[model samples]
Target: MTTSPLRRNTLKLSLLTLILMGFVLSGCSGEGESWNGKDISGLMPGLEFELTDGQGRPVTADQFDGKIKLLYFGFTSCPDVCPTTLQKLGQATESLPTEAQDDVLTLFISVDPERDSPERLAAYVDFFGNGIVGLTGKESQLRQLAKRYRTTFGYEEPDENGNYAVSHSSAVYVFDREGKARLLIRPDLGVEEIRQDLIALAKADT
Candidate 1:
């Protein structure tokens, strides 16, 4: 069979289009699988702040640079999630290898700064672990930090008895040594799972 010059050109163009489409589709597939059985990445993690730690000294996110940082956002008064999550984190941190543990930093950032004063946050975190750092600041500062991290938090009105609650994201963010968000662990994650992931992250090169 004889093929015309126009038919040959048309075939070449069609093959080129198919090849380009395959490349695009393959890239998308790989991105989709990057988070498979792992935490989501892409969100940036650190924000500049002059928050006060449990010791009443100034602290900034920069202090955690060049280490694996685990940041948890919650209030001291949280009836359930905050305490439980911190405890889990304590357990996880305890399980890390010495090298990994030395390279990890844990932070508790309170969304309810109105009531979660530095003293309150410090005591709360200390109950879970000695090395866990608690961060609290002016409401505006806390809100700005949360916004930078795309974390959501709000206060629920108190009932007739004047008791209130806070609704906040329960995901613990994992930041790589370079301060880039690398993964998220849900509140319900087991201590062992969190420990394993943190170890893997600490060992991962930037």
Candidate 2:
């Protein structure tokens, strides 16, 4: 029996889709429980930063030097990505053993410093129900850090209602215990996958 034209087209499309998926999976999938994120261990985009914490204290990246860190650039008012990623980071780390959990820290650096004051950052960070350390600083300092990390963020003009929006990078940067940037995790990765990767990175040098 001859197949219909529609069925032939469908088969072709499905084959093409599978080919594309194979390429993506091969390029993106790290070793399941080993380096499950994109390995940038030797890359220099996320070297360091000098910023303030949620409580308005002067803090620098080196201050978190000895611990593994997860860094993301966003604002308290971010409509979705920032908060969700923070929660994922929180949940993933919490899945670790107590001692392993202690080895990891997540930094939510505010790209909208003008609106994300220390007080606002504290409330926003706390609302996520985890131990993320909120941070913000002068635009100049943040801008420099963004440049170094290749993270981009900017504010749109305010609307008639005096509201605005920001466009920023959504990559989760993982730094090892030695302060060397290691993995660039995609925000859309699965929670379990991230949990496993976080554990692997945290214990890599320990």
| Top candidate when judged by lDDT against the true structure | 2
Give the candidate number with the greatest TM-score.
2
lDDT of each: 0.71, 0.76
TM-score of model 2 vs. true structure: 0.81
Model 1 lDDT tens row, 97-130? 7766777777888877777777777878889975
Task: List pairs with backbone clashes in candidate 1.
Answer: none
Residue range 1-206, candidate 2, lDDT tens digits? 98754455445545543553444455654554456677765555445777888888998778887788888888987788887888888888888888888888888889788888899999998887666899999999988887776555666668798778776777788888778877778766978988888777766677
- Measured by C-alpha RMSD in angstroms, how accurate is candidate 2? 10.0
TM-score of each: 0.77, 0.81
RMSD to true structure for each model, in Å: 15.6, 10.0
100 in model 1: Cα distance from truth in Å? 1.9
